[model samples]
Target: MIRLFKVKEKQREIAENANGRAPVKKQSAGELRLHKDISELNLPKTTTIAFPNGKDDLMNFEVTIRPDEGYYRGGMFVFTFQVSPVYPHEAPKVKCKTKVYHPNIDLEGSVCLNILREDWKPVLNINTIVYGLHHLFTEPNYEDPLNHEAAAVLRDNPKMFESNVRRAMSGGYVGQTHFTRCTC
Candidate 1:
């Protein structure tokens, strides 16, 4: 059986060489699924997906969100996504690339989203995650938060929270934290 398999592999190698092209690498299940998700993506007009590592590296990508409404409206936020090879079984690691004052996003770009955490299920795809992220900008959740201070302001004084978000998005200071202008 081993000999037969080796012979077949050698034949395939020879055939590939004859074709004068590099042998194509087989796509893993995760890669295949990611490709499907990307192809079928129903992204919002305000959101855009980018492959900074080029189109070849599908496992890593970036998502840019520009909310059309809410306090974050007109502010541009970028998030990085690193999908594992065993995707569906494991949620993608997502991090905000833009520094902004938001209850669900921390200073270090760590996001506090249920779907990305304990609520993550194999059924959820990249499109679902993108919608969830868009939801965060439209309605910044104050209940479960990574930035406790921001959450507190949102919970206790929503007007103040709005001011803070504006300050952060306009390249101003929110407390001691300096934020770059992300508003467009």
Candidate 2:
């Protein structure tokens, strides 16, 4: 196949109209895979994807997940994804954009999903990763917690964990840490 603008440094050039008519850069093997993965994405009812940097830049975007069922019900969680020019072979960089009390997500918005790291494979797509993130909210793992205090409370006193989550979501403090407003 013929190659076009250099994938590594190519920036989408805008046309006269603000309608965003920039040509799609000829993707790399990795980017081609990423495009396919995104095009075939099957997000859940409670999940929505958005491109903060505009549709021209599909390499980076955000996914919002609101689990309809489980302890996380009613709360909104956001995840950011940054795909590399060499994608698919490498999982998109994902981070928690919402501040929530979860064992898998730290206060700094870093996520602890296996599929996003060591367990990632080229076969996985945006759908797979989104589902994996949804699962984390539905069933937070006590075994591997990014928030140790939250984990301990959940393990020792289930009721307390629930209470803390409620408090945090209400734009309150769980302890010394102050959580921003949440829809969950």
Report, for every candidate in turn, its global Cα lDDT versus the true structure: 0.95, 0.84
Instruction: Superpose all Cα atoms of candidate 1 onto the true structure and report the RMSD in Å to 1 decimal.
Output: 2.7
Best by TM-score: 1
lDDT for position 182 in model 1: 99
Q: In terms of TM-score, how similar is model 2 to the real structure?
A: 0.85
Off by over 4 Å in 2: 1-24
Q: List the residue pairs that clash in candidate 2.
A: 74-184, 75-183, 75-184, 76-184
Query: What's the distance in Å from true for residue 133, model 2?
Result: 0.5
CA shift at 88, candidate 2, in angstroms? 1.0
Residue 74 lDDT in candidate 2: 89
Clashing pairs in 1: none
Q: Per-residue CA lDDT of candidate 1, range 33-125, in tens?
A: 999999999999999999999999999999999999999998999999999988878899999999989999999999988999999999999
Error of 1 at 175 (Å): 0.5
| lDDT of predicted model 1 | 0.95
**What's the TM for model 1?**
0.92
